[model samples]
Every structure is written in structure tokens, then in C-alpha cells.
Target: MGRLPEAPLLLLVVTVSFLTGPDVHAGKILVFPVDGSHWVNMNLLIQNLHAKGHEVTVVRTATSWYVKEHAPHYRSITVTLPQAIVIEEEEFFVNFLMKMLEIKKEGVSPIGFMKFYWEMLNALSNIHQQASRLGVEILENRTLLQSIRDSRFDVVLLDPGLPVGVLVAHELKLPTVFNVRWITSGEGHFVVAPSPTSYVPTSGFAATDKMCFSERVKNMLFYFLNTCIDKLVVCPHYDRLVDKYFGPDVKFYHLLQGADIWLMRVDFVFEFPRPTMPNVAYIGGFQCKPSIPLSPELEEFVQSSGDHGFILMSLGTLVKGLPTEITSEIAAAFAQLPQKVIWRHTGERPGNLGNNTLLVKWMPQNDLLGHPKVKAFVAHGGTNGVYESIYHGVPVIGIPLLFDQFENVLRLEARGAARAVDATALTRQNFLEAVQDVLHNPSYRSNMRRLSALHRDQPLRPLDTAVYWIEFVMRHKGAAHLRTESYKMPWYSYYSVDVCCFLLAVLLILKAAVVGSVWFVCFRLCRRRKPKQE
Candidate 1:
């Protein structure tokens, strides 16, 4: 009876200890995100952070197409811009897609290639210049700047594609974590990591790591163009802003390269083997989840497909519909297939709509992909969709358009899990042929299933990994130990050009000394012999 009383006392003590355990540390976070599809990825990350008890403040432009001014997850600091950037306009992208399709229809001609890239470069320049204006606006607002300073943010999380947050972080003297895939120059890896031209294919080039002589030459050319774009298109706008705000000598690219961590949205299962940096953490498919039961209407449709199954089609958040001509062709092709189709399209209906195809403004993409009835996916090769398809183990019929889509499709095609059709050259017959190949061939499904297994076999979910690293930065102040100091060195020093020159000079001096010694000895011998003769 005395021991029973002691046991109750011990239990109360344990409960008190559990209740008094340390709470999660809530860090102050500031965010500058690029609007539109990029926002989709950023929003999910913000939600996770908020759940972890972090206080997040997001900076949005007044003309933002996607980011709302008020959100339950984060506080907003909206800056007013003169106008939205070119990339923000939906109509501009639609028209741009049409132009690219026209250029791409001509196949692999130098003229056609140049035309396509030239248009891209011009559009890129305009977007960067306009984005710079946002940075300028933020810096000029003294009140806004003071509030950000007073908040004492732990880290500035940003998308470096536009890099408005980079500027703000520099001004505030805070560490940064980049949620990045693309940067101003090109792919984010090129900004800090070792990318050899012999194997590392440039973005938008449809070549894999294993390239022939001609493909290698083509890759080099694309790399050269990327360099020109960085210098001509990227540097001028950001450099001026950096100079104006941060002082005269601060290089914008160096500031860009000096981030604390990079949470790259790709993994080996989806990406080819390449050299990466310690600071870069691969978190591909972080946004994916197991399927939920669909709505009754959608469930009925899936059941109705019966033994034939159904194919899912979505061109991502952007590109709701292709041109009428292209859509009509696609619809005509779908008519011949026995498999039911659920296509996400907007605007006018295609002239040649098929009875087997169901058109909707939007569908639950992830849930639909996870469904057992999903036989195949027709996607425009966006990173999010590609990862989702990989997560679900669904084979793809790729209809690529715009930046990086071509390269993305090529990777899948090389792996034998997907078939790529030229969006510009797609006719009913060729498009139908590609679909039939993927549907009938068991290899595609098996390969994708293998990839899905590899992706899912990780010890921690990708999202958890990303969050751990981010909180790691918050805990330790910054991840300077993982970051390389190569960004601070000049190009000549970083490339070891100075070291190479010094070694060459030392060798030349040694060679000269040896020659001089030989010549002197021969002369002395000749003179001594002549003296003996005299």
C-alpha cells in the first residue's frame, strides 16, 4: 500500500517532465519568390515551415499573378512595381510557344536553332531587366527596408531565378537558402559546381551525358551561348543594382554564388549522374503524396474506362491549350486509341474531339496519377509533372514545348520510359504511333516502376531532408562549412590559370639555365684547345 502511493507520485513526476520538455525553436524567415508555377513549389515549402513553428514573411509584387497578398501560412509585404515582367503574362507565353513551335518545325537546321534561342535570349533579357526593377523598388522604399531590418530574420529563403531576395538579404546582412532549379545564367549547378562540357549537357540541349562528337560540339555551342547570355543579358541589370545599393565593387554573381544552401528539386532517379556540391541537397518529388479517393464523378469515370484503363494529360499550370491546329491534331490522334483520356484544357474546344477523351479545366493531378486506372501520362515535360509521373510509376508520352522541356523529355526517352514527339511537327498519325508504342510496350511501365522504387527507397522522405537542412542553417547560423570559397576568387585564380603560368615560367627558366651552362662549357673547351695550339 505504501509502494502504490510512491508509484503514483513517480508517474506524476514523469508527466510533468514530459509537459515541460523544450518546445521547437521558431525562427524568423523572409522569402522572395518568383510568381506563377514557381510559387506552387515555394508555397508547399512555406506550409511545411509554418507547421514547424517558424514565422515566415513573404515579399510579393503587387502585380503577382499567383501569390495572394494575404495568406494563413505567411505574412505578406507587397511591393508595388510599375508593371509585371514579360514572363508573368500568360498571353505572352502562349504566343511565345506558338513562335517556338514554328521555329522547331524546321528540325535541326542552324538557322532554326539560332532563331529559337535568339527569341529566348531576347525574352530572357526583358524578364531580367523587369525583375531588376522590383529589386530597385524594394531597396528604394525606406519604410519597407527598415521593417525587414527590424524583423531580424534568421535566413532569407528565395528563388534565385529572379534574385530579388538575394538583394534584400545582402542589404540586411542575413544568410540565405535558395529554393532553386534555374538561375539567371542557366541551370543552378553551373553557378557553383563543376560542370564539364564533355559530359554535362547545357539546359535546352536534347543530348544526354553520353554524347557523340557532333553532340559534344553542339553542347559546347550551347554552353557558349549560355555564357553570352549571362554576360550580356543577366549581368548588366543586376550588376548595376548591386553597384547602386551594395557599393561599387560587389559582384552580383558572387553574391548569387554565396548562398548558405541549395535545395535543388531533382534527384538521381530523375536526373543523370553529375558532379554536385556539398551545399546542394537534392529533394526531388518532395511535393508528392499518396493518392486520396477521387470525387464520385471522377471515380465513376475511372471505373467506366474498364479493362482499357485511361491516360492523363496536363500541360502543367502554364499552357492550358496549344494552338487550335495542334489541339485538333492531338484530339484526332486520341480518337483512335481505345484507352479513355482525361485532358486538362482551357479555352475553345478542339474541332476533332473524340468520344473517348474527357476535357476538363483542371484535374487533381497527383491523385489522378496515383490511381490504379492510370495507364499513361501525356505531359509537356515540366519538372513537377515529370517527378509526379516518376513517383506514380506511370510511363509518359512527352510533347515538349518551351525552356528545359526539350531536355527533360530527352532524359526520359534515353531511359526508355518515355517517347518524345515534336510538338511542332506532331500530326495525328505520328502522335498516335507514339501513344501506341508506350501503351503496348511493357518495358516503359516496368522501367518507370523501377525508378519509382528507387525514389521511394530513401531513408527519409525528400521533404523531411530538405526541412532538416533548412533548420540546420537556422540552428547553426549558416552552413559556411559546406560552402566553397571558390566564388570569392577571380576566374583566373579559380581556373588555376595563374598557377599554370607560374609553373610554365619556372620550366622555361630551368631550360634556359641548362642551355646556357652547356654553351659556356663548350666555349671554354674550344678556347682552351686554341690556347694550347698557340
Candidate 2:
């Protein structure tokens, strides 16, 4: 009885077609994610790609549990682990936390730091060998390699945290994009940009952008040491693996140097000022999403706290199984607060736990942080936890435990949004005071709200930016044009140290010539006056 006008109907049809028709941007994508938190972080980007109609496959390792649980539909090729040498998730985390505690106990003197560094390298070497073996297994499987080749994937996304992804990308002969879950490392930075140690501090040191003389010296030394460790210990293992699986034609270092783009999980708001190349895209809050409604039990618990609000405390997944004594101290601190506490604990319940505190094995951290009833977050200062708290405008009480955590918490502390306490020195009074300071102090909340606004004020959301660049790389085959010429230069040349040396050499040569000419003139004068002198 009633038909729409032809012009309006045509407009509606065109809009519908644009929205629902086959995606012109879709590409076949292959991802190589390191296990645990690295995989969890990459899964967010993977989900976005999948939703955009891109075909994706992830090569899963033994440490991958989150990917299987979260993105079960995405295709995966599991690397089999030998039963004799299998390391369970619980065991791995326990060892990691123990090492962290050891480092905390033994202060970071130069010698002590070197000792710890060697130990870490040894552990990493073991893991690298395991990952290499897995890579070899995958490549040796002719059927799998044939299928992957036949799929003709457009590009490979990799987490360079471990070296497996670099090997896989090279074997496939695909354009590579490195997805790192922390501030870009020296290795990652050198691949696509210049990382000047003069201003750009390494990941772990708690130095600001403007460093004192001592701090800069330490930064330079650490940068050099870390590079040596990577070259001597890490890269050689990867080289052997590449030679074994792919052949000597392609080296691991070459793969890294040729990376098309680096999807770094960092933002200028949170990070100190540093130079980044065009190929280095900062997707800081890519994992952060609009808060989901909390579970019924969590809602009730949080709502019961009234205007006093509650605090959310978690050390993240990798730092579980802390000592019971430490947990007891934390519990005692929480008991002193008027606000209720939601603590994520993996071990046995602390005997001194307060009535207002609730301990759970896991919690939806981001959703709880977004709740109005949540006032402050007590966390281990991991990048993910810090970003989520900042996204929700929740102030933080940071207890830095391990690598990069110290640096992250220090930045937040500098910004007036957080207070940090050393995990080794954490006492009931100190912890309670930190919690009280952030909750009662209006400045912390104000700073956090400002940061949250700044973080959210962007032309495009971080996820969309990440996806656009990912697709851009696929569309262009490789975004090599965006890469800086610095990537191809040696360290000395890139920093102009060679130029300085050449100038010094020229000055020395000129000085020597002047001295010789003066001597010759004095000798000739003496010879001409020799008879009169006699």
C-alpha cells in the first residue's frame, strides 16, 4: 500500500550494501604469538581482524592457554611438547615469581645485576631452544608447510618477545609485523627506528626523559649490555634454528631488520617523550574495551560498599603464587581501610585477611575498574594493568615486581596519578598508607581523570588504528617505504659517532702538519745564521 520514494530507497540500498557486502580490505593473516600475556594481548588484535572478515591462523605453543580459551574459533597449530620436559603453567609462574623475589632481595649493583642478567639469559636460552625445536617441527611437517604456502597468507604478525615468530616469518617468506606488548625494546626500535640511549632509556630503568648524568651513564651501559646479550646469547640460537629449518640464506637478524611495522603497546601519554618512526604504531589501549556488566556476585559486593567504594588489587597472571607471609601483610593492610577490597590471589587464603576483603582466583579487572564504586587500584604495575586503570580513570597504588614494572610505575608516580612501593619493602603500614593516599587525595583522582581524557581523545580508537595499519601493510604487501634509513645503518653511523671520529682525525692531521712546518721554518733560520752564531 505504501512504497518509499525511489531516491530515498536507492540511498538506503547503497548504505546497506556498503555496510554488509564482502569486505574489500580482507586479507589472509598468520600470527605467531608467544605464550601467556603476550598471546593474550595479541588476541585482542586478532579478534578485531577476525571481525573484519580477515582469515587468521595462530601457531600455538605449549604455554598458550588464554588463546585457546578466548579465541577458540580462530585456527591454531599446536606445537607438541615432550612429556618429560613439559613445564606446566603453575610451575612456570612459580619459578618466574621466585626469580623476581630473588632479584628484589639482592640489590641491583653492577656485579649483582650482571649475575642476574646471566641467569635470566640462561633461562631464556632454554625457552628459545624449546621454541626453536617447535619451529623446526612445524617446518619439517611438509603437509603443514604445504598448506600454509598454499594458503598464500598476505603477512605474518609476530611477537618478538620470543624469537620463534621471526623464524616462522622468514620460513614462510612473508612480510612481517612485530607486535610487542610493552614499550619498544632496543632490538625492536633499531629494526624500524632510532632509539637514542641519550634520551630514550631502556625498558627497566626508572629514569625519566630528562636524565641526570649518572642516570644517562647507567642507561648507556644497560643498553650496551642488553644488546650484547641479544647478539651473543639470543641471536646465535635463533640463527642456528633458522639455518636448520629455513637455511643459511635468511638470518634471524635479517628478518628483524626487514620488519614492515612495529605495533608497540605504548602511548605518548603514558610513555616519556621519544622519537618513533612512522612504521612504529602505538596501540596502547588496544586490549581495553567498553566495560562489560559485572557478574551478579561482584555487583552485589561492590554495591554494598556504598560511597566509601572499594579497591581492586591484582598482581596479574604471571605473578601468582606469592609467599603467604607477603599476602598476609597485604591482607592486614586492606583490613585497615574503610573501603572494601577485591584481591586476586592464587595461593591459600591469608589467615589475617580482613572481613572487608574478598579474595578470588580471577576477576574481570577492567569492568571492575570502570565501576563507579571502585576508587583505586593496587596492582603490580604491568603495562596492561596500568593502561586499564588509566583508561577507567582509576588511581593506582603500584607495587612494582619485575621487568618494566618499575619503569611503568615510576612514570605514573611522576604524573601524580599513582604512588609506588617496592614489593620487597611492602609493609602493612606502607601499603595501607599508599591506598589511603590515592583514595583520599583528590589530586590523584583528578590527575587520573585528566589522563583518561587525554588517552581517549584521539582521532581514531587504538584498535581501529591498529587494524588500519595492519590492513595497510597487507594492502601494500610491505610498508618498507615508511621505514627509516637508520635501520640499515650501523650503530656508530646512525648516531654520527663515525662523523665525530672523522672530524677528530682531520684535526689531528692538521695539528701534526702545523707542528712540522714550524719546525722546518725554525731549522732553516738556524742554518742560515749558523756562521754568525759560531
**By TM-score, who's the top model here?**
1
Return the clash pairs for model 2, or none. Answer: none
User: Which run of 10 residues does model 1 get worst, by summed lDDT?
Assistant: 17-26
| Candidate 2 ranges beyond 4 A from true positions | 1-23, 69-72, 82-88, 102-118, 182-187, 245-249, 495-502, 511-534
Q: In lDDT terms, which candidate is top?
A: 1
State TM-scores per candidate. Answer: 0.94, 0.89
Query: Scored by CA lDDT, what does every candidate get?
Result: 0.89, 0.80
lDDT of 2 by residue, 319-399 (tens): 665677778888999988889999998877787889999989989998999998999999989889999998999999998
- The residue-by-residue lDDT of candidate 1 on 1-534, one tens digit each, is 446688899999988977985433789999999887899999999999999899999988788888899999999998887878877778877888877777666556787788777887788888988899988887898987898899999999999989878888899988899998999878899897999989999976889899999999999998998888789887799999999888988888888999999999988887888899999999999998899999999989988999999999999887757888988999999998888999999968998998999999989999999999999999999999999999999999999888898888888888889999888888999999999999999999999999899999999999988888888888888999999998899889999999999999999999999999999999999989997899
Candidate 1: lDDT of 304?
A: 92
